[model samples]
Target: MAGNSDPLTPRAKLAVTAGKAVAAASRAAGRGSGSVIGGRVALKLDPDLLARLAQNLDVVLVSATNGKTTTTRLIAEALRAAGPVVSNALGANMPAGITSALAGSSEARYGVIEVDEKYLAGVARDTDPKCIALLNLSRDQLDRAAETRMLAENWREGLAGSKAVIVANADDPLVVWAASSSPNVIWVAAGQMWKDDAWSCPSCGGVMQRPGDDWFCGECGFRRPTPSWALSGDHVLDPHGSAWPIHLQLPGRANKANAASSAAVAAVFGVPPQVALERMYQVQAVAGRYDVVQFEGRDLRLLLAKNPAGWLETFSLIDPPPTPVILSVNARGADGTDTSWLWDVDYTRLTGHPICVIGDRKLDLAVRLEVANQQFQVCENLDQAVQLCPPGRIEVIANYTAFQDLRRRVGN
Candidate 1:
């Protein structure tokens, strides 16, 4: 008997098969493989399998160093406000994870995905998104990303010759430069007082200045058209939290940026500003990013700090005369085996002291803290650290793996 062989159908079958195989492989790696694939049998499908599942679904691919998840979710919600939408909301940003998401959806008019920077180009090539939202580029995951410039170049190559409308953050110098070469790009400028990192020519190494939230190359005079949609104001009255009101469900400057990016993406999809505001107010923080929890009669804040950029943003948001904190770091291969990026973080900002250092890499954290003149108690075990630390308004910083372990330990 001959094996099943129909070109299009077989391709579709292969996609399904590969997807299931990926999930199984992830489980075998000791990761929570089910969160995204969720009880789906192994099929080992390929990208073509998605074609069999649906047709004419608009794809929105969102990529950035930070804010991808929130922006993707907000955009998905805004699209959902218009009609039914499907997304991989489980922080699965790679090609396989995206395939799994498409496989699981029943009916979807639009598909919004948060893509990893390294995978963005390939995903874009394969998925052919209708719109690609490129948020600000920042230094993140040095071990993986290597450099922001390289990632930007990869994005440029990935997007070349594609008909996808480019929605970009104009204030980011790298994004501005990348979009300058592309026609049909819609720029979105950050609001007032938004301090962007890419303020100069990425190629010429000249200072790039923002004159009125619109970026222009000071030296080369390379400039892109200002954003069609811009988010500006003192306060947006986010019910989740307010800077002026001085209360936030998620505490940090980064959160504000995340919210702003979300709003911008929502606006691009024709969501009414008023409706966007209302929906944003109802927005809740995700599990690992500045999620406040009440555990054991104590208030605990879980802030995900995966890389140096994240660390800087987290540190900037924290108010200090020395708040008690639990800092966790891990150097496992799966959790970013390289820890050299620690040097890029300005640990001095966390001046006063940490209450405890938890995780397998406690000594490394302790040494870094002590070197920065910040006192800390080291605990090799996460459970021990949690038990020993007193409750009440505690801040916990954890890397990807450590964050997951801590969440499980705290039952969050």
Candidate 2:
């Protein structure tokens, strides 16, 4: 049981109460937690309570800078296909949110969760999951996460005491090297040519060379065997548009990588790879994470842009560009108070293109676009921006809070 004096417990209780209150209010108002405000409150409070509840179940925790939500959802879906699975389907990766999710579920054989990197150590201490999936780590939320090296070190220490089977990303030097000492590790690799970042070894500060489709160190010679599961060749047939035949509703290489990771983890739990892949094709994009909606005769595509890698990958998927994009930015405390990470995004890719900027931080986004030598029309508000977007097809890149605001405004 959590110590009473632990500050987290009281805060957890308050959060849980607030969540229930909000749910009640939404119901009374004839709405649902899918509402903008309801979703925000739910995301904030659920994790803490979920962490507390996770103590009762056999948990599988998944954590990474990218792909955590998609992988978690995929694993949960596959596990359900096999049997019963309890999971936080809304991308609640923190301990409390996970606990809340578990609390809402009935007794189940598996508790599969997507955990946040910052809170993984604490959650692991409380729940002691049966399996831990450590996906790739990259530079994200620099203001909060510090550095990749620091996060890797923290994860190593946190996972040191865990007895759970470790599932790692073999191509990511950070994940592979960090989990090298763990005896029960399952490594998954996604083709050699697909390696985008993390050029050097995280251990011994050595140069990492690609031995095959996987990575290895020339100095330390810490090489990983080929992944028990791998995704080869060109899985992404459509790089420029969202209408890909892969059957995944989300676009880009990142989604494909996420699908591959989820399949691998599911395979380890007695779910066949073919069955997992079949279910993966049925995977729908989570709300606000590349979900396309019909709005007033216009197709509005919403892609979440919380970090640089995510933003870059999203842009890569929309090649040739949407005629006029409604780019919204918000630096609300809940959506990450710091906005410096915006500089890290490759806005230069939009050079010579025109877009419509909207939201509380519209001027800031316009400034960014101007700095990148791109053209954009700044809208005073989201409604005007939505109204101005061409009718046939439109794209929207929004931060967390701005996404909800836009969704509500567009009636999605």
Candidate 3:
């Protein structure tokens, strides 16, 4: 019920007020961040609260199997060059959490939401966003979420006839298939790290032909689209053939690809590429991923990788051998209850590094490492893991719940 030109209905106003109170209480009680719980309460009272709060706002929905949180943060930072922006920057990418984020700031000019792959269609329908940035699609939480092609088909069907501009990754064939139905689409050549899930064509179920960086279906002739935005070594080539250098405090090529996509999404709002890149450089971390924190006189750098595709990209972010890597895994609900995805990741990349494993599924990771012929020690907790290493910078890569556990333990 914060004041706006188009005010919320009385019922929606009451719902928002109650939701805000619940969020405040939850935070005060040290129970949780309260976004999800508060949003659930609000929706139970007024089911249309999300739509009502999103009215008159330029919303951007970001979805992907990986990098969506960071990309959403980057996009939100760039959009701030225009006006006030509201975002679930803490990685709450669900309907309830998104609703709580929007309801909290009723007068914001924009809403940038990170949405789960399974929930994008519903959120898009409610928010009626101005832009939808489809980052990439791969096997993620498969025990809960559907297959990659099925998710892509849902996106294609859900977004059809919608007026939102689709900013999609040209390098990811699944993303291309998902965004193909949209009339207004801007394809950016954001590099894809894992191509295992996209081997077969979604259209004709034929083998996809990849010649260097290009991909085409052998049966139906569905081909990779020419991207308007392309990323070179350290620069992004805009549609006008202008090269803009992407210098970010965030490390890795994945971040550069994310920045390239963010610039393209911001362009739809009239924000220049250089300006967006400048703003994006200020973001040091997103929702504790890649956050460097001090714990027990040691610098612990936290990295979150939930799936095989994400783990492949995260492996590059780790420090070189002898730096000592701590790998943690969990099979909690947030993380799919199947640790079998661990076998898909090539843990042999950590060879020569002093590796330690810790989590609910630490034994599974230990077995995977053993199969890779990599030496590792299983530790009960982060404290024990850190004790094995000397007092210096240590890399801690963990799955979803394990990452959250470390964040709490390290006081991040």
Candidate 4:
């Protein structure tokens, strides 16, 4: 599965050529943010470039409120066994990122892309992907994404006649609801830890009964779907109930679910589950996340906490007492204008841990921590905050822009 290095159609080639020039200019002007502007220019030149590039190619699209970046990375890494793959390695999930990734690797036969949740339907329809991994969707970037129910409904409609085989998360009621309409689906019980978003049945608005790991609507018969692939203890059970040992270098239980979701797709592509997990085990970071690097005088490990659901998982992964952590936040456009989601997280989890708040929303976070009875220090600069931490590997957890800012400071 080597890349298709051969030139494309005349129009597409010309568009790419123009795009490369724009990208070069952007870089020279120090405004180039990865392949963003370049891709945008190419797309502007040839509006059909994405769809055209996707033609006659094996493409897999992964979308979710959180974990899409890591999950896409896992899928792409696993597909390496199948040979050449081009992907959004920078964790850019928008159309520009996808366009840039595809335009550059014209020779690639397989494309593994992480799509923004809001752009799923359009991208999926245009790309005509072979497999669509529908991970759990929660309330993320509400200022930009609005209601989760609306997104789910839109996705259901978008995938109504999709020819792609949907790799679905049966454990997530929202994911199940959105993907159930798809004709061809492979269900995976990847385990949903964040139940706040799917507490009620999306169908009848009835309270979902969660007596155990299983969830069902009392009014309507909607319930967790029977999965062909499920996470049972340390093993992932195949449809035949054969247990496949699951292990990942990626931290948090959420990552385990991410790996399971990816394995389900790899199976559809004929890549064995073991082979997928083996390759995924080598991925320590996606973009700048889960990376350990020296900053200032202390070592810092990065974690991107985008929403309440994501923060819950990250909170659990933090080191206990005596360990210091730097929590950075920003209310930038990319991070969503509303920072209210911070109150939804159980910040009490850091009861005894020392805290250092940094970023644009440092004061807001400081207030949140104080109300939670957690003591903290406010240091907006990452370098100054790093100097304040005790002699140990510090956990630097931040929201979108803050994380990117910290990543740049770490020279990552």
Candidate 5:
């Protein structure tokens, strides 16, 4: 909560200048937006660059296993109702990228940052945010972060005694445990369709019993707290018992849950829930997610699902039957070199679609589909997959790098 007038030290000022210069040079070289490399240089010059850059701005840090980018974008858009907001809109959620983003926009009154799940605690500590949104935590990147419970514990410890208002999901046990340490919290009953990671209680290591919509640890007293905000179908039911209809350009119940979390955070900054929601409806897509592009007289809708939990959500948004579906995956660094997570996803849901597989890990995906008794065509790339389909709309579901590759090729 440092004010905007708080001047940066001489070293910090120099670091910011040098970082911006490197970013510009990187852009000229077409090495992608220089956010990460430039941020590294800045942090190297001044180790405290992120904290210094966050001074005087009302920061809102958003973290989740899924929907981090989309939720961050929604939060930023809702905050625009108050004043100018700056964000790392292109999925750069690490400390260095965050430093570069804040350093680049000094005039903005607010900062909305999407944080990688594993790095959320560090980012939260440095930013000292006005509000923090914990959407959900599930199994993601087994190679990198295998312990989801450890992540929840880190969140609980990192946010202990923080003054920020916590906007968290009441439906997810991992999120509930993580945000429970905070003194102030606004709980939202955002639906959790994938509950594989939260069966064991994080606090007591006991089995959680879900008799109905309520979940409680039988051994320990830890349970789902009564939600102040709840989602019923397409509406967001607030604490005041007023149900507001959520009409978002982004499809699925997942995006609606994200909007509910965003509206709750915006309320802490004096923006009304209705006003915040009104602003959020304008966000049709986050980066390339849900972006529809035309290629070779066919429409392709791009969806990014990096893990099993994410895949479950994306499956609900895809077009029903007869619609050709393209499944792509990669074992790249960004996509978590392990493709074993594919088995956890229910490929049986894609029963009627003419499914085509592509990417470096297409063979793995094909084998999984085959195990499910689902027929699929293995293709070399997206263009070949699209060629297999008739002239019409094609649904594309890909992991991190595969989605990015399709987006670039399709000019999205």
Candidate 6:
């Protein structure tokens, strides 16, 4: 239970009251997740609910095609040193989730919220966050988001009028363009692993040059901006080239980049980069991501891989050589309902690892793995799939829905 000290008007209070009742009922009935419907009801009652609720609050907005949820959690954890930070803790980035978060803890003066890629500008306008962290952009849920550049273009328009200081990833070409015109910006050289969505310049359609870690366009002047903070090997280097060790519980180079970005944002509030990183290390999991749940009498480390880029980064975290992993792929609506992106990813990395595939889209994944010449066996059911693995610390990677289903199954 959180403190209650809302400054809302009588009408807004009534709307929120009704919304909470609906959310409680939804949770009791188990009809939906309750995050969206509660927000929907609140918005239906008061369309300007978020704008009104955001008054006098210090808010931070985190948006990206991937890692937004975990990044939001890290930033929120860091912000807690200052005071209580309200956020959508269930990995909900939509308006409803933000509403539920704000309405749930109206007393908190600080908020660390995750905004979906498409709705960043609008949410920023309404909530008017004190800082907006722009993480990397790649092809994710393209059926709903369209071209990856369109999101960057929207950010350009949406962030033009933003008064908040911008903390953006300079390593990503698309993010560089998105934060180009913004007046106040803190650039971080967080790595971009996926280059499929960045073949051409978003500005002039010119071929992008990847000389080394950064990128530049031949026709357009667009290029990776000089970063204020950058990841050097296993360390995060400041402008003075001083190295700070990134010892986070979240594994992989991508999480190091996320912690670096979070530290950059925390620095704006006078939190030392070292202090911020220390707090981030306390975070072992974001939602169900990176959780080691006991399932079917074996410890399963859960990895959420929603798209090609997500799979690439998540897979890199697994220990090298003979790593046994459970690969589940589901083409649910939340996962963009298209399994075609499976081909875009180079699954040959799993050649040495023992692979067991499951889920509704297991056949599609099996076909992909077979063509990639990876040795793997298919299991018809997840329960039976767990029995196939050795009884020990087995690693499990799944797409959006499959991951959530497993999380619920394991009671995480």
Candidate 6 per-residue lDDT over residues 246-292, each given as its tens digit: 88888888898898899889887767777777888889888878888
Q: What is the TM-score of each candidate against the true structure?
A: 0.82, 0.81, 0.98, 0.96, 0.98, 0.96
Model 3 lDDT, residue 21, Cα = 96
Worst 10 residues of 6 by lDDT: 1-10
RMSD of 2: 6.4
Q: What tens digits encode model 3's per-residue C-alpha lDDT throughout 28-126?
A: 999889999999999999999998888868999999999999999999999999999999998888999999999878558989999998899999999
**Which parts of model 2 have CA positions greater than 4 angstroms off?**
1-52, 191-200, 207-218, 222-225, 234-246, 351-353
Better of 2 and 3 by TM-score: 3
Ranking by lDDT: 3, 5, 4, 6, 2, 1
C-alpha RMSD for every candidate: 5.8, 6.4, 1.7, 1.9, 1.0, 2.4
lDDT of each: 0.67, 0.69, 0.92, 0.86, 0.91, 0.86
The 10-residue segment of model 4 with minimum total lDDT is 1-10
Please give, for residues 182-251, the per-residue lDDT of candidate 1 as tens digits. 5667666543222445655776778777666466677877775655555444343322233222122555
Instruction: Identify the runs in model 5 with alpha carbons over 4 angstroms from their true place.
Output: none
Model 2 lDDT at residue 147: 82
Residue-wise C-alpha lDDT for candidate 4, range 1-412, written one tens digit per residue: 2244553678889888888788888878877355888888889989888887787579999998888999999999899888789998887678977888888776567899999988999999888899999988888886888688888998899998789999999988998999988899999998887888888889889999998889999999999988999887667777777787777877888888888888889988889988888888889888889888977667789999999989999988877887889999999999998888888888899888888899998888888888899988998598778788877789989999989888777889
Supply candidate 1's per-residue lDDT for 228. 59
Global CA lDDT of candidate 3, please?
0.92
Q: Write the per-residue lDDT of candidate 2 for residues 1-412, one digit (tens) a residue.
A: 1233333466665765566576568768866442334334644764445445555566788998777887888778777777778887777565445655665555566788888888887777777777788887777655567688778888887888568778787777778766765677877664322244567667777877875455677897777665665554334221122222234666777777777677667766777666776677667777557678887777878878777766777777764654567788887765676777777777877664458898778877778787887878898886676677767667788887898888787777
